[model samples]
Target: MPSTTRRTAVAALALAASSVPMLAGTASASSHPSTVVSAPLAKGLYQSAYSERHHVLWATTAVGRPPVTSSALLKVDPKTLKVQATSTPPVTDAATGAVEAVYGVAVDDEHDTVWTTNTRNNSVAVYSQRTGKHLATLPNVAHAREVVVDERHDLAWASGFGDGTVVAFDTRTFKEKKRVTVPGAAPAGLAVNERTGTAYATDLKGNRLIAVSPYAKDPSFIPAGNGPISVALSPDGRTAYTADQAAGGISVVDLRKKSVTRTIPTGAGTLSVATDRRTGRVLVANRTAANVTIVDPAKATVTETLPTGPNPNHVTVAGTTAYVVDKSGAGPEGRDQVHRIRLGR
Candidate 1:
C-alpha cells in the first residue's frame, strides 16, 4: 500500500511537469533585451522610435537598394546609438508574389511582439521580441500605409493608402474586427486617441482629415490644409498637427473644434510631424529644405530650425535624441544617414 501511494504521487508530478509548457504557452510571452546588431543604414533610414521596454531604437528602411531595402527593420541601442538587430518580414516566393514594403512598425508590449505594416503587399507581420522570429502574417489588407497599435483597446488600426479605408484588427487573435470607410480619398497617415476611442486618418489626395469613432459608425472628414501627409496628436489629446506636403506647412487643429486653428510654414516638401510632450514642442521634417522646424504649441510660433542631412523625410523624438533619416538618392546606393540631435542643447 505504501509503495502504491508513492508511485501514484510520482506519476501525478510527472504529468503536471509535462503539461507545464502547454499551460504557460497560453499566457503572453515576456519581452526581450535591447541590443544592436547591424548599422546597414547610416544614411537612408526613414523612421525610428525607442521601445519603452526593450530600450532600443526601432527604425524602418525605405523601399529601395541592396542594404536599405524596403523590408529592412533595424534595432539600435538607445544608450550607445549602435545597431543591435536587423530582421526582415516573411516574403513570398517571386513566382507567387514579392514581400510588401514595410513602412511602419509599432511595438506591442502586452504581447512582447513587434507589428509591422507592408504597404504594397497589404499585410501585417508579427515578430518575436526575443528571437526576432517570424510569428505570422495577417493578410488581405489593402494598400496598407501605416499601423498604430492600441494595446489598451486590444486593437491595431491600419491605414489603406490605395483603398481609402481604415482596418482594425484584434491584436489578441490577429483577426480583422472592423473596416471603417474614410470620408475623403487616399489615406496617407494614421493617428489614434485610444483613450477616446477615436482615430484620425489624413487624406493626401482629398486634402482632408477623416475622424473615426472606433466604437461607433462611419467616420467623418474635417477639412484640413492642402496635401496633408502625416498626422500626430499632443500628449494631452487636446490638439492635433498635420504635415501638409503640398502646402509646405503644418496645420494646427484644435480637437474640440475639429478645425484648423493655424498653419506653421516650414521648408518646402514637409513629410512628417511629431510632438514632444516633454518640451511641449512639435517637430516637422521638411524634405525639400533639409531642416527640422520646431514649433511651440503654446506660443503658436516656430521656436527653432535645425539643419539636417539632405532630404530628411521623417523625424522621431526619443527622449533627448532626435532621429532623422536623410535619403540622399532614390536608389539603393542613396546615402541616408540617421542623425542624433540632442534636444535643448
Candidate 2:
C-alpha cells in the first residue's frame, strides 16, 4: 500500500489507463514465440502506450536529474521491438508554462497526436505523432496523472488527483472542455469506454470506483478494494479490474450493476494492469512482488505468475505478448527496463 504521502500517485483494462492504455495493438504472432526484452529506457520510466495507425509503442519517462530536457517519449516499433524515435513532450511551453513530469500517455490516431500528463505542471502536453512536434500545452489539468483521448466526443479526458475532478479538453481547440467532480476525495486512476465515453476513476480515499461521462452528467460508483490505485476494463467492456494496492488484490466491478462482483487475491503492491486481447486474460504488475500475475477475470482466479525484473510498475499487451515496464533503482535489476512476457511459452 502507498503511504499517505503517496496517495497522489497511480495507472490501469482500462481503455484509458493512468499507466494502462492499449499501448500495443494486436499483430501477427512471431515465429520465434519467445519473450523479447528491451534495454532500460532511463532512470525513471513511466507509461507504455501503443499507436495503432503507426504500429508503434510509446514509453514515457519522469526526469530525475538536471538537463531534464533529456527526458522523452520513446517510440518503439512493435514489429521490430526496437526504440525507433525519442520525442520530448515540452515541459514548459508558451501556452502552458512549466510542464513537468510526464506521468500518463495516450495516443490519438485520427488526429495524429500524442497526449501526456504533466503532474507537476497540472497540464496536458499535446504533440504531433508523425512529426514528433510539440503542438500545444493545456493548462489547469489539476495535478494530472493519466490521460485518454475521447475520439467520439473529440476531447481529451484526464484524471485530476489534486482537485478530485476529471478534466476534459477539446482536441481541436486545445481548450478546457469539461470538469466532472469525482465521487470520492482523491481520484487516482482512470479507465474510459472509447465507444460510449463512459469513464471509471479510482478514488483511493473513498475506496470506490466512480463512473461518469465526461460529456453527460450522470455519475455512479462501485465499491473498490482499499487503496485502489489503477483500473482496467475487460474486453467486453462490462467488467472493470481495479488494482487495489492496499487490499493486495483486484476488485472486480460489474459496470452494469455498479457494484463489485468479487475480490481476487494477488501479490502485494498491485500497481498497473492490462488485459490480453488474444486470450481474455488480465495481466497485473505487482511492484513489491517483482512479478506479473496473469488472472482470469471471468473466474476471478490466478492462472500463472511470471517473474519480472524489478518494480514492474506498468504493463500492456499485444496479442499473447505482454510488455512490462520497470522503474530505475527499485530492486536487484536496478535500472529501468522492459520485460516481454510471452504466454503459452
Candidate 3:
C-alpha cells in the first residue's frame, strides 16, 4: 500500500472524465461480435469481470486516495457503459496496517462474494458482491495477482507472482487448504475447472502452463510462449490459450495431455486473453500494438484488430460483449480505460 500522501498524488491522475470516445477503429467487421461502445475511466486499470446473476460488469483499478475515497470495485452497466456503482473497499491489513490496493477482481455470483488480489499487501480480500462490504481477507499469498473462486469445491485459488506458487483457500472459513508449488515459474494468472477438480496456472518466467490438483504428485507443465502473462480456458476445460507477451502470440494447449497443440501468432505484445466460447472466438489484448485481436480458435488465425489505446492489457467476455482494461503509465500514471465491445454473434 502507498503512503497517504502518495495515495493523494495518485488519485489526482484518475480525475479524468469518462467521456472519452467509444471505439477507436475496427480493422474488420464480423458477424461474431462488434465494438458496441468503449468509454474512458480513471487511470490505474487492471481487470474486468461480468456478473451473470446480477447481469452487470465489475472492474478493478489500483489507485491512491485523495479527493475520492478508496473503493476499488466499480459496478458498470454492460449495455450502456454507465457506471452503476462505485464501492470503497476500505480495509487496513491487520498485519501490515496498509490499505488494500486491489489489482485483480473476480466475481462469485453464487456466493455473492467479490474476490480481489490485494497486490500491495500480498493477499486476497473478499467482499459482499452487492454491498461491497469487507467480508474477509486471506493473507500469506505473496504478490497475489489473480484469484478464481471455485464455488462447487468451496475453494478460492490464487497465483503468487512473487513466490512462484499457486495457493488455495477454503471459501467457507477462509483458511489455507492447499498450496501447489511451481519453482521459478513466477505464476501470474490461473484458471480453475471446478468440474474437473483441476487448476491451470501460467508461469511468466518459465514460459509454460501448469496443471495442479490435490490428487497429483506434482504439477504438470505445458510449454507455452515466452513471457506468458495470462491464460484462459475453453468451456469444456479441454483447451487453454496462453497470452505470450514476449513471444507475441497465443499458445493453444491440450489440457487433457498438458501439451501445447499450436502456437497461433496474434500480434506483438499480447498481454491478456479471454474467450467467448459460444462464438468460438479468442480475444487477446496486444499492449504494444494497443489493439484487440479477435482470433478464430478453429482456424487458429486472427480475424480482426480493433484499436483500444496505447496499452490494452486486460480483457474478458460476457455474452457478446468484450470488456478490455488499459493501464497507461509514466507521467501521473494516466492509463485507466475500459473499452467495451459488442459482439454480433
Candidate 4:
C-alpha cells in the first residue's frame, strides 16, 4: 500500500495532468475514418515493441518510485490485445531491496529475446521471449531510458540518459560491447540502422541528434527541434524522424545530408514517433493533446490524428498496425492503457 502523503501527491499530479488544455494546430479524429481498438492494461505502461517473428507485442510496466513493488514484463497478442504471459523482474538490491522495474522495451526476434531498460536501477535486463524467463541483467548503465536491438550486428543498445552516453551489449554473449558518450547530451530516445550498425539518439537537453557509429572515433551531431524525445528511422534508413516535445512537432532529417529538412507541427507534447513501412506514414504521439498524429513523410503533411487517452507516451508500428501506450487513467490510481490502430490502404 502507498503512504498517505504519496497518495496525496499522486492525486494532485493526476488532477494537474487532467487539466492540461489541448494545444493548437492538430487535426481531430472526425476528419479521418479509421478503426481503433483500445484496452486498459496494468499501471505505469511506458514503452512497447512489436515482434513480427513471434506475432506478439512486448510491453513494460512499473509502478511507483524507489522500492518499486509493482512491475511486470507483458507478452500480449497483438491481434486481440490480450496478455499471454507476464514475467516479473528480479530483485537487485539486498539492503534497500528494490525490484528491477522495467520502463523501456525492445524485441530481438533473431535471438528470441526481449531487452528492457531498468531506468530506476540504472541497468538493462534480458528475458526469454519464449518462456519469459529472466536471462541476464547488466548494471552500470546510467539512467537507462530506451533500448534498441540491431539484429544484423547482434547488438542491443541502451540510452544512458543521466550520463549522456549510450551502451552497447552483445546479444549472443550478453556482454558490454562499448559505451559512446557526448558531452552535455542527455539521450532520451534511441534508434538504430541495422544494416550500417549505426545508432541515433535524441539529445533531450541539447536539442540535437547524436549519430553514433560503431567504428567511428567521434560521434556526429545533427540539429533538431526543441526537446526531441523520441526518434525513428525510415525503412530505407535514409531519413530520421523525431518527436519534438517542446516544439509540438516532428523533425524530418535526411541521413545523407545530416540535417533537418523540415519540422511538421502535429500537436502539443509530441513524445514518440514511429514510421509505418506499409503506408509510408509517420505516427507521432502527442502526450499533452491526448492524440496521435499520422503524417505522410513524402508530402510532409498531416493526414490524420487519432485520439488516445491521457498522456500517450510511446508509439510503435508493426506492419499496417500501430500500438500506443499511455500513462494516466480516469481515477487517481492512474491505470495505464494500450491502444491499437489499424492502418487502411
Candidate 5:
C-alpha cells in the first residue's frame, strides 16, 4: 500500500453528507439470498480486478515504504480468479512507487484489450489480453483513480484525483481524445450508461457526483452525500449508487433527477458499490466490517448483510457471481485478498 495519510473520520462524515446523488426508489419488493466464497490473496493488494469479457484479472503488487518501487501487473484467469501471467512494464521513476497502484480495471471486449489506472503513478497501462503483452503507457494522469471502457462509444475514460478531470482515450490507439473537468477533486470511481453516453464520476474530496455529458460542456453536478468513493449504475441506467467510505452507507442517485434521493446505511467504510441488474439489488462492500450489505433501492432499505473477505474494496458481478477484492490492511503496507458471493441464491 502507498504511504499517504488516511482519510480522517470527519472527512469521512463529510463524504457521507455530500456524496449521495439524487437516487430514485425503484427497487421492487424482491428478496434474494447471498452465497459467499472466501479466498486468500497476495500481499500489497490495492484494488485491481478481473475483466470477465477479456478473460483476465489485472492486479497490482506494491513494494517498499512510501511505495517507491514500481507496481507489478499480474494477469489472472477470469473464470478461475487466479494469476494467468505477469509483467512489470517500465514506469516513470517519479511514479515508480505509485505506478501500477492499479485501482481500476476495464476491458474492451470487442477489441480484446484491458486498461488499468495507477493511482500513485499518475499513468494508465494498456495491455493486450490475447497476447499477454503491454501495449502502451499513457503518462501524466493526475490522480488517475479509476478507468471504465465504453465499448459502444469505443472510448476509455479515467477519473483524475489531482486535477478533478475525467480523461478519455481511444481504446485501440491509446490516444487522448477528450478531457472533461468536474466540480471537485479526487475522482475515485466511475460508471457509464452506454445507452445514454452519460459518464458518472464520484468525487472523493467534494462529496458530490458529477454527471459528464461525454458530448456536452460543463457536465451537470449531483450531490452524492459524504465520502462518495465508488459508483455503479443500475442495469436499466435509470439509477446510480455511490459507496460513501467515510459515511458508512451508499448514496442513491437518480439519473433522471440528477439528485441524491437518499443515503442508505450499509456498514463502516463502504468501500465499493455494485448493482445486480438482474436482481435489482445494490451490493455494498463494507471494508471495515468485512461484509457486504444488500440494498433494496425500491424500498430505500438494506435488505440483507453478509460476511465477506477482510477489507473488501471492490465489488464486481459476473453472470450470477459477485467478486469482492479485500485489502486486509487499510494503509500502504497492507496485504490483499479476494472473495466471492453468488447473488439471487
Candidate 6:
C-alpha cells in the first residue's frame, strides 16, 4: 500500500464520502440470487478487477476530460466495500505537466503488479501491487481503453481504441513485444487466455471480435453484434462472450467455429461482461439501464437483473462475488461508486 505521506498527498483526488447506504442487500425476484452493497469511491469510475491472490479489488477513475488532472488507482476490500489504498499517476505530460489519468485496470497477480490504461493520455502504466508505486508508463498507445495480463506468458495486452490496434508488452521487461492492427476497427475491451497466450479484443466500430494469437501470422476476426465494447472468455477458452453496447445484448462466439452462435439480449447499453469460473455464469453491466444482468450461458438466457446505481460501467468477478463500478451517485454532483455483489455459491 502507499505510504501515509503519499496517501495524504493524493487524498484530495478521492471522494470524501465513504460507503453509500446499502443499495440492495436482499436478493431480487429472479432465478439467480445475489445481494448488492455500494460505496462512493471517486469521480469517473470506469473499470475494476479483483485480485484473487491479494483478496482485494482494483479500480480506475479519471476525473473530467482533456488534460485530466485528477485520476486514481484504488485498492479496495471486497468484503467491506471500503477503499484500502489510493495511488495517483505521476505527471507524464512534460509539455502540459498533466498526470496520466487511469481508466482501465487489470491485476497481474503472477507478478504482484497492476496494469492500468491511461486512456486520455494514450498510454498504459504499471504499478506495484504491494507498495502502490508507479513502476513504468508505456506511452504512444493510441487511446488505450483496456488492458489484460497473460501472466502465464508474462505479457500485458492493451487495446488501442483509437488506432484499431492491440499491443502486447513484456510484463517482466516493460517493453513492447508485439503489435497487431486491424484497419478501420476501434478496439475497446480486451481479454487474454493465459493458457494459450491468445488475446481477444472487441471491435466497437466494426462489430467484430479480433483474435490475436501468439504464433499466428495474421489475426482472425469473428463476427459479433453491433458495437462490442467489452469481452470475456469461458474457463475452457472455447467460448468468447462480448458485451455489445450499441445492440444492447451479449454476443456468444464459438471460438472453434469463429462465429457468434447466439446474441442474447441482456439490457440497454450492455457495456461490460465477466464470467464466473465457479458457476460459469456470465455477468453483464448495463450502463444505460443501470443494472447488472446475470446470464446463464448454458441455457442462453438471462437469469436475473440486479439493479445497481446509475450508469453501471464495469463488473468483475472475484470468486462467487461480483464488483460493479458505476459513474453516477444519489447526490447532485454524481460521484462514482463501487458495488460489491455477493453471489452466493
lDDT of each: 0.68, 0.72, 0.76, 0.84, 0.71, 0.84
The 10-residue segment of model 6 with minimum total lDDT is 1-10
Q: How many backbone clashes does candidate 4 have?
A: 0
Best by TM-score: 6
Which residue pairs of candidate 6 clash?
A: 1-130
lDDT of 6 by residue, 101-196 (tens): 999999999899999999888899999999999999998789999999998899999999988889999999999999998889899989898888
For model 3, residues 1-345, the per-residue Cα lDDT tens digits are 111121121232233233543344455666553543455665677888889989888888766643223546788776666678876656565554345778788888878878899887788988887787889878888889998878888888899988888988877788888897776779887888888768888998888887888567788888877788899988888889999989898988887787788888888899899888787779999999877888888798888877775688789888777888787542234446677776555
Q: What does the lDDT come to for candidate 6?
A: 0.84
Candidate scoring better on lDDT of 3 and 4: 4
Q: How well is each residue in 1-345 modelled by candidate 5, as lDDT tens digits? A: 111233333342233222121111112234545545443445665565556666556666655554546456677554454566776655455643334445567777778887878766788888777775778878878868888889898889898888888888888788988887754477888998898887888988888887776688777778887998999998899888999998999988887887888888889988888888787889898989877888888898887666653577788776676777676642223445555566653
- Residue 12 in model 3: lDDT: 28
Task: Judge candidate 2 at residue 67 and give its lDDT.
Answer: 31
Looking at model 3, report the run of 10 residues with the lowest lDDT sum.
1-10
Least accurate 10 contiguous residues by lDDT in model 2: 1-10
| TM, every model | 0.81, 0.82, 0.86, 0.89, 0.83, 0.91
* Model 3 spans with C-alpha error above 4 angstroms: 1-21, 29-33, 64-71, 91-98, 329-335
Q: Residue 102: error of model 5 in Å?
A: 2.9
- Estimate the lDDT of model 4: 0.84
